[model samples]
Target: MSLRAARDDDMAWLRRHYHQRRAAEFAPLGWPAAALDAFLDQQFALQHQHYTRYYADAQFLIVERDAAPIGRLYLLRRAPEHLLVDIGLDANQRGQGLGAALIAAAQDDAAASGRGLRLHVEHGNDAARRLYQRLGFEHEENLPTHAAMRWRAREPVATD
Candidate 1:
């Protein structure tokens, strides 16, 4: 898999991906399908504006495999800590090791820079939470809607 800078043309796909991933989350709230779509449309626009305004310098990347877009990864490279703002895969592309590989690469980058990698996962996202834990991330704090996690660079062991 490879990453390319997200372009204006990608906005539609990003919106669709966001909608698909979040639909199930809102399904439990008992909203009708049409109502859910309307709600998501407004929410997504607000979220996109917020991210662009606040994280203008963050790298907005589209994850691609074989020249086809498969996901998105937004990362903010900062001193002492690298924030993984968001990472999502197409529903069909998930559970195939792509996310893991991307995260592992981020971990390697963080270690090389002596920085910690941090992210927030939705509280109900058990699969993602498990993946983070299995990759050595520790729960840092619980937010209103999400759990903050951190993975620090491991200290080198002295060889005998």
Candidate 2:
């Protein structure tokens, strides 16, 4: 798998994958299909340009595989540090190490930039929570949905 800057060519795959992924998450929340669709439409409209802004700010990227968009890794620069806004895989790609690879890529970016990385994950998402913990992230605060976490850059070293 490889990561590339998003292009118009990647939109179709992104939309389908994103909707599928979002639907699964909202499903457990008891959201109706219409509500989920509206949320996704709004989210897409609001976020489609994020990579451009982040890239300008030097913060985000889209992860691709075989030329198809597979996931996203975004960082929000907040003065003292940056928060990882999101990192996720297409539904079909989960369990294939893409999620972990995405997080690792984010961590690699943060460490390379000499800044700490932070994120939030649901308390009940044991798999994700454990992955973050394994990568040396620790709790910083509690969010309504989960826990705010941070991983301070230890030393400048490459990890693959």
Regions of candidate 2 where Cα sits further than 4 Å from its true position: 8-12, 28-36, 43-58, 76-79, 155-160
lDDT per residue for candidate 2 within 53-160, as digits (tens), equals 654564445777787677866666655666887777876788887777777777787777788888889778888888899888998898788899999988756879
Flag regions of model 1 displaced more than 4 Å.
158-160
**Whole-model lDDT per candidate:** 0.92, 0.75
Residue pairs with backbone atoms closer than 3 Å in model 2 (clashes): none
Cα misplacement distance, residue 148 of candidate 1 (Å): 0.7
Worst 10 residues of 1 by lDDT: 76-85
TM-score of each predicted structure versus truth: 0.94, 0.73
Q: What is the lDDT, from 0 to 100, of the residue 69 in candidate 2?
A: 70
TM-score of candidate 2 versus the correct structure, residues matched by position: 0.73
Candidate 1 matches the true fold with a TM-score of: 0.94
Alpha-carbon lDDT of model 1: 0.92
What would the per-residue lDDT of candidate 1 be over residues 72-148, giving only the tens digit for each residue?
A: 99988888799998999999999999899899988898888889899999998999999999999999999999999
